[model samples]
Structures are given as C-alpha cells and as structure tokens.
Target: MAPAAITLAAEAPKLSAANTGFMLICSALVMLMTPGLAFFYGGMVRVKSTLNMLMMSFISLGIVTILWVLYGFSLAFGTDKGSLIGWDGDFVGLSGIGLTQLWDGYTIPVYVFAVFQLMFAIITPALISGALADRVKFTAWALFITLWATIVYFPVAHWVWGTGGWAFDLGVIDFAGGTAVHINAGAAALGVILVIGKRAGFKKDPMRPHSLPWTMLGAGLLWFGWFGFNAGSWLGNNDGVGALMFVNTQVATAAAMLAWLVYEKLRHGAFTSLGAASGAVAGLVAITPSGGAISPLGAIAVGAIAGVLCAMAVGLKYKFGYDDSLDVVGVHLVGGIAGSLLIGFFATGGGQSDAAGLFYGGGLSQFWKQCAGVGGVLAYSLVVSAILAFLIDKTMGMRVSEDDEVAGIDQVEHAETAYDFSGAGGGTAARAPQPAPSATTAPNTKKVDA
Candidate 1:
C-alpha cells in the first residue's frame, strides 16, 4: 500500500536580495553623515581648533565601530532582558549568528541589520563632540565616548528600539531616532558643557565660523545622506512608507530652511549663510522621527515650528550661561523634542502604526505618550551624561590647559594645524623688505631731497 502523501510546512523566512541591497546602501549613506558632521563641526569652530573639531567626529567612527562589533550591538539589540538592556554575551563578536539567519520580520540578514544600526551608534557620540569643541582634551574626548556609548547610548537604544524594551512596549512612536539619537546626544552635550564649563573666550571673542563654505557643503551632504537615514529606516526598498518618509524629509527640510531664514531676517536684519545651514540641520532633526508618521503638510508645520523654535532656543545658552559651543542643545535637543511631540498631534495613522494623532481624532493619548518618552530620555541622558563627564573630569581631566587652549588646541592637541601661512607666497608678503630701511632718511627726520 502507498503511504499517505506527506505535507510540507511553509518555507522559513529567507533573504531578499533587494532588501539586503537597500539596507547596505542605506548603511553607506548613514556612514557618510559622520564625515559630513565632521565638516559641519569643523567649519563652525575657529581656525585654531578646526582640525581638532573634525577629529572629534572622525574618531567616533573608529572607536564606536570597534566597540559596536565587540559588544555594543548585543547590548543594544540582543535578546531583551527585562527591557532595560540586552544581554551583551548573546551576540558578542556576532557569535552564534549565521549568515543566512534573517532578522525577525525583515528580509535582510541579521548582520546587515547589525551594521545598519552600528552607523546610528557611531553618529550619536559624534553629535556630542560639537558641544565640547576646542575645550576638551582629545584623549579625554575619546575616552568619554567609549564610556558614554556604553553607559548611555547602548542602553538608550535598547529602551527605544529593542523588542520588549520599556519604550518599545509602552507604545512610544519613534520611527527613527528622535529620542535615542538626537535628544540623547543633545542632552549629553549639555551635561558635559555644564561640567566642562565654557570655552576660554565664550561671549567675549567673536568665535565666528572659520569657513562658511565648508559648512554649507557639509549641510548639503547631511541633507543628501539623510534620505538614507529616514527612508532606510524602513529596511525595505519597495515599501510606500519609505517614499512617504523620503518626500516628507525633503519638504520639511525646505520649509524649515525657509522659516529659519525668514526668522533670521526679521530678528537679526540679515539672512546669513550660517542661518541657512543651521536651519537645514534643524529641519533634518525635527523630521527624523515624525517623517514616517505625518503627512507632507504636517511635515511643513513641524519643520517651520522647529526652525523658529530652535532659532530662538539657540539664544538660551547665552541667557542661561551654559556655553554650548555649537548650539547642539538648541538644534538637536529642541528640534528632536519638537518632532517627537508633534507626531502625537500630526500623525495621520496612515503608515505602519494604526494610532492616529490628536488632529486625526485620536485625542490626547498619543500626545501624552510622546511626552513621557521625551521626558524619560531627557532625564536619563542628563543625569548619566553629567555623571560621566564629572568622573572623567576628575580622573583624566576633560579640558586642555589654559595655555594650550589660548595658544590653539589643534597644534597642542594633535600637533597639526588646519592651515599654514608659512608657504613661499604667504606670511604677510614679507613687508617688501622695508625698502632697505629708508637709507636716505635720518633716524627721526623726514627724507631729504633725493
């Protein structure tokens, strides 16, 4: 007798070439944001500290990359242990994870997901560097990030994104990283600035940006790379959500730039290049989380509000005497909060989540959830960052010596300068050799008849 026909179960999740390719490209784009950030921060600093500023951002790429692979990813995305943090040993060195293993619902391999998230981790610490520009020691900066990423970023990423994490389980809606990346970094910046104090010439010297063109170029790059940041968060190329996010990103960024320029013109009587660059960044930060949730019109509102609010917020440091070097607190912290909270009011419930916002007739429930997420991250980051800064200040010393700072941190810290006026045609043109010391003239008298 023939045996009964055997039935086969549906196939397990398999890799999708399109999704893998999309994620890999997104990772590269996200990686570019770090160097773009280096240029942005570099150009904002005085010439003497330009290279140091660039180095501060660049070093995070090196340091965080190593740490991420070793144990950072596991602590961030590994199997959740009570939702506070992941088990570091679960994926330490990416052990026990096979090349063919797919990340839960996504079609990409687990490694691809890991690397993509690694880019986010790399930039979060670098974002803090802008606040401490020129003042902190390079060695100490390096050490601080290594510690901060471990204590602050890893756990925060888990809280916001990890499965079963408190924020994830609590129904908080952070499509990208409004809370984990921007707010976390911004608050950390403020904390360190409070401990490190102001730059030597804060509020007294001009401290103008050495190169506005460099900053403009950096802003362009950041804007270009942000497509990957927001759209790629979807982890798929074919999803309409990515397209919505992409369009919202562009629209919001443009609106924010225009709003900032208008505000600058009205308040300061001039629309400056610096304002344009900064406005663009503020828009980028504001749209990061809300892009996936809100409509393009809502994005315009969010961007415009963030632009105006952050422009005003930048002045808060001067009033409060915090000396936030590059306005990280102003742009990132304020913009992030604006975007995250606005989602509760503007979310259309048309994307991944079904939760509608207040304007969409969902009421104030989502709004309150957003407030809780924002407040929780802000408080946790501020306290932890302050403790970390204080400990480092006590142990290894966070600031350069006064002499080193006054003379220029680039030469003292990195033994290199961003520019050199010692070239053959440089150095004040040699004063034309002083015309042979006016040989025909007396020491104290005017020249005689030649």
Candidate 2:
C-alpha cells in the first residue's frame, strides 16, 4: 500500500478544531437521513410489504459502508485516474494514513472527510429503493447495490466532485450531488424498473401508501438532516459558504411545500399530506445543487419550479406505462435536472465561484455546461444501470414470484410483518362490520399519490 501524503491547501494546512467538530456533527446528521428515507419509503408501501420497503433502504447502510471502507472511498476520492476515476492503494481498507493526515486541502482529518463522504455513498443507492419497493428480492437488491455503487456511483462521484474530474474541471457547479447522488440514483431507479418491468396488477390494484404519518415523519426527518447534507458540502464554514447553503436550503424547502399545496388544491380540489411531504423533498433536491450558488430569492424560484415540475412528473409512469412504485424518478431525477440547470440562470457572481449566471449577464455559456453534466450523468447511469439490473435479473432473479408479491413481500423476504392485525381485540368474538361494496354508486375519490 502506498503511504498517505499531504497536498497542502494554499492557505495553511493547520487543522481547525471548530471546522472538524462542525463537520462531525454534520456527518451524523447526514447519517440520520438513511433511516429517515427508510421510514419515508416504508410508510408509502402497502401494510403487508412495509418491512421489505424499510429493509431495502436500511440495508444500504450496511452494504455500502463495508464497501466504502474496502475500496469505495478510494475509487471515489483517491488520486485522479485519467480524470475519469480515482485510485490509491493507500485508500483501500482506509489504511496507510496517519490519524492527523488531512484530506487533500481540508482542515479536518482525512478520516472525517471519508466518513462524511461515506454517508453520501451510503444513501445514494438507498434512494433507488423507493422505486423498486415490494417487488424485488432482498438478496438481489443487496447484490445490485454492491455492484451499482462500485460500477456507477463511485466513478460518477469522481467525475463530478473529485479533483481533476472532467465535470469538475469543466466548471459544472454541483454544490452537493445534484448529479452524483440525486440524478444518478433517480436515473438508476428508472433503469432498474425498466428492466424488471412493472409490479403485478399495477393499475388494477389500489397501491396507495399504507401510512401517511410515517411518510410525514420521514419527510420531516429528511428536512432536518438536509441542513447537514447541503451546508456541510462546503467542507467547513471557514468561507461562510456553508451558512449560505444552510439559509438557501430552508428558504427553498418552504417555497416548494407551499407551491405544491397550491398546485394540489387547484388541480385535485384538495391538498393531501403526501403531496405536502413529497413537495418538500422536491424542493430539497432542487435546492441542493444550486443553494450554494444562488441568492435566497433565486432559491424560491428554483424550489417553486421543481415543486410543480415533480408534482406533474410523478404521473408520467401511468402515462408512459412504467411502474415507478414511488416518485423517485419524478422528484429526484426531474428535480436534480431543474436545480442543476437553474444554476446557469440563478448563480450570483458572489457565491461559490465568480461565474455569473444568465440573468446576471453570464450568457448561455454556463447553461450549456450545466446541460453537459446533467445529460452525461443521466445517460450513463440509465444505460449502465439498466445493464446491471439485467445481468442481476438474469443471474439470480430480481423480482419475487407474483404470488409472493401479492401475499406480501415482508413475509416472503424477511419472515416478518410491519404489523400483526390477526390477533387484534383478543381475536375478537365478532368481527367489525366491513365496508360495503358498490351497490348503487361507485365512489370516485382521487387516488392519493406520492
């Protein structure tokens, strides 16, 4: 293994206790988002399939962490390899580095940065689980995350964030994973679903979320943790960029929530809680890439745009005939694209870089650059992810039996259920009255959507 060496920041290489401590807290917050996502997805699934939905996300915490320590971090942040990937024998197993060694030019110990980035690596694939919920086998999902993280995520992170990465060098301003995390996971979700095909009885069965409260709690937790996910991307608060990111995160999320509720009321006649929760996430995704670049007012516009766009997008599956069980492709993919491109119009010259956006007289130059990053990652992830899913499906079978899916994936896959209504009320002597089937009039309620 090669020994770790220092590449000093132009300013001093001295470690700041404040920065280190702040980042450590931020890492914890980001780590919390995985479970938050699990709850978000878990609640959206049918009662019989909730555990499997939760497991699909929680398992990534285990699988990706081990991989990150083994070689995932190395492939993502090690020495530049042809500006396409990273490589450093020293980074494998996170060995050969001293305790105090800094990461490139950062103030925190290399360990802190690795763990922080590891959180990102962990959740990116978990984000895809939302779309594949209830239909996939646990074993196949695990294997797929392993391969997808290594084959698709690691290299893409290098491409967008690592030093000497092509997109980074081209000045594509992804403040924090508009491309690497959200867009990549969203596209991969679309790809895998395309290969696996739709869930059984897609349009026939009423696949509404079993628990909106759980989804709401999950969304709230995600909103809380996102401060860390966005602000901490600046590495530290030394330059005040982190503070701006924090502010913009809040501003944009609030705007998106309101925008979505208004749209829901106008179009559907009532604003549902699911719409509110999903709208919040849409804003979060949209603001993630542009928060550090745009001003607060600009953030409101981005959030509102993404809110409506994603709200309208979630229905595309029904229109186009693919079953994205959750709106992963809609919110994450579309929102990521909106946020990344909006940077070209909203980036103020005072933020992350001096690149003036179109509204600020930067012209169409930066917009084209943003398109390159968005299009490149989307195309690569979609094609490669489809291929990976196909290979995994062919080898071990990705979907469970249709009978098993109908019965409940939790019982088949995990041998457990989220709730046991069987023994309720001491196996009640008399059953409660069941709802009446249609006799005179069929209800025409609008189905609740994610």
Q: Of the candidates shown, which would achieve the greatest lDDT relative to the real structure?
A: 2
Q: Per-residue lDDT for 1-450 in model 1, tens only? A: 323322222344568998899899999999999999999888888889999999999999999999998999999998899989997574798887888889988789999999999999999999999999878999999999999999999999999999978999998888889999999999999989999999887887778888889999889989999999999999896659998999999999999999999999999999999999999999999999899989999999999999999999999998999999999999999999999999999999997588889999999899999898899999999999999999999998999998899888999999999887776473565645654556566374322110
List candidate 2 stretches off by more than 4 Å.
1-10, 427-450
Write down the TM-score of every candidate. Answer: 0.93, 0.94
Q: For every candidate structure, what is the RMSD over all alpha carbons to the true structure, in angstroms?
A: 5.6, 4.5
Pairs that collide in candidate 2 are none
- Across 34-130, the per-residue lDDT of candidate 2 in tens digits comes to 9999999888888888999899889999999999999999999999999999999989999977898887777899999999999999999999999
RMSD of 1: 5.6
Question: How does candidate 2 score on lDDT?
Answer: 0.93
lDDT for residue 293 in candidate 2, whole number 0-100: 92
Give me the displacement of residue 175 in model 2, in angstroms.
0.7
